[model samples]
Target: MDYFFAVVAPLAVVIIGGCTVRSVKIISEENEALVERLGKFHRKLESGLNFINPILDTVVLEDTLSERVLELKPSQAITKDNVSLIIDAVLYWRVIELELAYYKVQDIEEALRKLVLTTLRSEIGEMDLQKTFYSRKDINKAMLRELDDVTDRWGVKVTRVEVQEITPTPKVIEAMELKRAAEFKKQADILEAEGTVRAMELLSTAIKSQSNSKDILQFLVAQRYVEANQKLSESPNAKIVFMGSEPLGSSMGELLNNSTISPPESNGSNSKSK
Candidate 1:
């Protein structure tokens, strides 16, 4: 009887000790785990101390409930207008249902990456190159909507999406620059022509508003003469020749007549004489 008691006591101690180690579960804060009993989901273990039938229970998965960020790789896509562009994006998501997340998807991150890329290309294909740059926010919204729709079944929620970068091809950028320069040059030409027209209109109005247009015309010609001489003086290779002293109005008028640009004044006619 003494030998029987000694042997049974050691076996009982071993059995109790093994059960204690297997049944005890201590999960950290912000962490969760799924327990499966007999090859089927039984319950979820929350943070803190937990007890389980270790003989029939297994901790299937343990992960944090923290938000995660997934940055997508850059990819090339063509716009509706057939312009090629490189695009990259980021996704913010978190697991809300661990069971479905593990059961429904073979690989979570890879699945999300493919889905995001497909949605991105689909959205981009609907817009032109210019609209892509102008409507970045619209693209992000559409991507989030599409991603959420499909990812909902995976037990994850996409909180937000951001289109980080969009770049056109080098050839397209060069073409855009050239097109912009041409537009600027065209506007400058139009402004210059308008300015010339305005100046001519003002000169006509000034001349017609005066009682004696000939006096104003003579003054204008004299002003032009002095300006021409001033510009010529500034040139290093200019040759300024002076003729015999004569009234500027007479000399300039004769020069205009000789050049057939305008009729000259007659000196032989007296005042009020036809």
Candidate 2:
């Protein structure tokens, strides 16, 4: 009987000591724990020393208060224009309610990831390829709004959603580049034509406003001839030849005489006539 009593007393003391030590839990400042009694939710254990029945209560779920980042794998989605694109994103979230985070959703992170992917696909499907590139902020805001609303019940707050990369297929990218080039060329041509029209209008106005149109016309001809010679001189392959300016002079005289403005008679010819 003495041997039996000694053995049972030591075993009981050891069990009680173990239970006492286990009942006192020290939680970190940034962490939370979900306590359950007999597999049923009892209460949430906050940061610092928390006590619970060692046999009956268990800390089933433990999570951090710090932000968590989840990087999504690249997902393929089609734009409104039917252009296929691959997009990947990163999500920033934190557990707001430990009980709902554990009890409401079996896997909060996975559910949040799927929600983001679905929302992203839907948003991308609504926009054209060009708009998708420019409207990234709008898309992110929309995703955050939707995610916050849906994830609220799960006790997860989605702080931010960032689209890491949006890549169109190689073929689509090539096509887009070509299309942009064509559009740029078209705009350049239009601008050139508009400038030419404006220049012509200004020249016509200046010519009409002149009192001596013949003098203005002669000046314009000489300026153009000088410009042409300058361009020919600058050309690497151009062959410069010394040509007589007599023909040009005669053509200018003829053009001046045919003009509506009468040329002033020379003083020498007038004195000789007098």
Candidate 3:
């Protein structure tokens, strides 16, 4: 009985070793494999232990179903304003239907890349440089929606689309900065003029209410004159001029009174005159 048991044990070990080496497969978690029987689709080998007919079944492809990131290179695009920009993006995607992904597209990665680039350029061409900067989220959502529609048939689920960078050309950047500075300067000048007008109105009201208004006005004018001299003294080639505070105050009051705008004549009066 011992001799028979020893012979059978050796034969069993050989058979088990051969099966383990050739037929058995361990598919990792989150991974899948496709098998073909005589060059025809047989079955999908899912995660965990799987056995295949060593002679007939062959693994055609193995891939993971996990989410993946595809980073796009900076592509040059012209905005609606004809401003050239360099933009890059990232795509979060995953294969929902492995069979469709493998058979439908010859090269899935290349197809997705081209599709994304085309969509990005199309969206960018619809917006100006300023809109492109402000509407970043809108562009991302639009791309995601557009890509999802097209890639649905390709078994790709684009989870998220992100615009990583949108940068204008160096010359465009400099021009934009200059334009912004001009806008700021114009705003400042308008505010300063409005403030001066408001101050003159307040001074006119004070003069009407008080008897010593002339003395107060002359003192204010002298203070402004000193401030102007101090600012001019900081300049490399400043020419200082001295003038009496009383004359300066009188002239300032006359200038303020003359700053009012005359209203246009009534249309009825003009017609009657004609």
Candidate 4:
């Protein structure tokens, strides 16, 4: 009886242990899990061990899925005006639909890669190089919106799309740089001309105010005389000096004496003399 009881006790303990054994589902702090019961989705589960119908329930990994990244290769495209350009971009995205992401597409990575390439080419073809470079943020946003709208049904959300780089031909870049430089030079010239006009107007006002003012003229003349003397001192030749206003008056008087004053003769004068 004791031996039979020991054998039964060990067997009962093994059965209970097997029945109580639970599958541990480990989840990271940043993750969530979706559980299925007999091929039907039941509910989402948080981190730690939760009860499941042993053979009938299974946990689907929603967090283990890698974040999708789409890299668009450089492609040749024409602008609105028929100018050619090479453009490339990168897109960041992830699957929000665990069911659709796994079921809708055969290969999510391959599908996204093809979609990104096609979308990029189509979008870039409609824009010019100038618009492509200058309005890149707008372009990226537009692409993101379009991709998100299309991919949402497939359980994908486009988090971000960015224009990584744009390379214009060397000739086009050089032409643009030259055009900018010329515009800057033209503006500088216009400003310089305006300044010259302003300076001339101020000088004219000064001259008009000083007009016929003997004191001011005398002062200017004295200044000029001083400058002239200083310059003459540098010359090797001797300068002829005429002293003051007195010498100028005497010279003029001598010139007047040398000239004769002639009077007109008339018939009336002759009659009066007779």
Candidate 5:
């Protein structure tokens, strides 16, 4: 009975130890495993049950290979218009190539942040302040493209770039505001001048079309006379005059004779006498 008990106990312990050693593995929902054999990369393990030889091979490093957000601090940059501004940005990226991401770059986050800043300065340095403020989306897109190109070799993928904040100096802000105001005023003046020119052109066209019509001229003159009469009646110090050709002189001779008036000045008679 003693011999049988010793043999059975040793067999059960060995089985339990083997199961425990085989159960050692990494479990995750959103991660990948890099397996190594003799300190050299052997294969990549996908999500699920991953087995490893605990004695001969081991998990040298555990890395969560997923998308990450890199926030950058404000950096001084010079614009095309010689204005200096501090710009802050955020970068969205992911590690696509786990092999390159883990082995090539020492620190992925730091490298990504530094690359973003360098690319942003180069892009923004070529544009003016107004463009930088308004064209942030466009600039971000361009920076993303540039970063993608440069980082592709390093196995890093840049998903998107965003300009978080742009802070220009107070003096630069004032100058930009003044410049914008002046530009708006110039545009308004141009529009007003165009409207006045259009109105003048229409008036000239109407005058030309009615040059041979006496009725139209008479109506215009009557309208002016009515307006003048109404304005004059509002104030006792105003005087209104509505005149015509020699027809009034011929028909109303008695009225002209009663008033202190002279005949129409004749240039021909005056020149002949001189």
Candidate 6:
């Protein structure tokens, strides 16, 4: 009888002590614990030592309260222009309410990833291929807003969404490059034509202001001759033609003569004075 009491008493004390210790849980600063009594939610366990009924209470869920990052796989989507593209993205989220996070969603990360992908596709579908490249901010903002609304019920806060990469097919890329080059060339041609028109307008004004059109005509003819000679000199086998300026000189003389021809009234006044 004495031996039985000594052995059984120590065993009972050890078992009871272990149960008493388990009644208190030590939760880390970055973590939260959910307590359920008889399969029903009783209270939440925050960071530090928490005391609860060992026999009646159970710690069902323990989740980290820190921010989490999720890198999404490349997903294929179509733009409003019907161009297909591959998009990659990243999401930032955190659990604000441990109980809701555990009970409201079966899989938080999976749900968040799918939400981000669907939202991305929807936003991309509303934009053209060109706009997708530059409208990343708008897309991110829209995704964050939509995700926050849905995830709020799950006690998940969507902090941010980032578009990592957008890749069009090889053929689409080539076509885009060609289109950009053509646009640049078109702008260059427009600027060149505008410069030519402006030059012509200025020349016309200068020619009208000058009394002796012969000087301006000679300068223009000489400049053209120099430019033509220079261009011909660039080729080794080029033939240089030295044409006379007599045709240009005769045309200028005729123009000057026509301008100097006075009215009949001025001619009659001069004749009467003489």
Q: Lowest summed-lDDT stretch of 10 residues in model 5?
A: 256-265
lDDT of each: 0.87, 0.89, 0.87, 0.71, 0.77, 0.88
TM-score of 1: 0.65
Model 4 residue pairs with clashes: none
Ranking by TM-score: 1, 2, 6, 3, 5, 4
Local distance difference test, candidate 5: 0.77
Q: Least lDDT summed over 10 consecutive residues: which range in candidate 1? A: 256-265
Give per-model CA RMSD.
7.0, 8.3, 8.4, 13.9, 10.9, 7.1
Question: Which lDDT value does model 3 have at 174?
Answer: 94
Better of 4 and 5 by TM-score: 5
Better of 3 and 6 by TM-score: 6
- Which residue pairs show collisions in model 5? none
Candidate 2 per-residue lDDT over residues 139-242, each given as its tens digit: 99999988888999988899999998889988888998999999999999999999999998787677777667767888888888888888889989989974
What digit string (tens of lDDT, one per residue) describes model 1 on residues 40-120?
999999999999997999998988778999999899889999999999999999988988888899899899989999999
Where is model 5 more than 4 Å wrong at Cα?
1-23, 174-274
Local lDDT at 63 for model 4: 59
What tens-digit string does per-residue lDDT give for candidate 4 at 146-251?
A: 7887888788888888878777766767887999999999999999999999997775456456534343434555676667777777778867563575664566
Candidate 1: residue pairs that collide? none
* Most accurate candidate by TM-score: 1
Best by lDDT: 2
lDDT of model 4, residue 39: 85
Sorted by lDDT, highest first, which candidate order results?
2, 6, 3, 1, 5, 4
Candidate 6 residue-wise lDDT, 33-95, digit = tens: 999999999999999999999999999988899999999999899999999899999999999
Which 10-residue span in candidate 2 carries the lowest summed lDDT?
261-270
- What C-alpha lDDT, on a 0 to 100 scale, does residue 260 get in candidate 5? 42
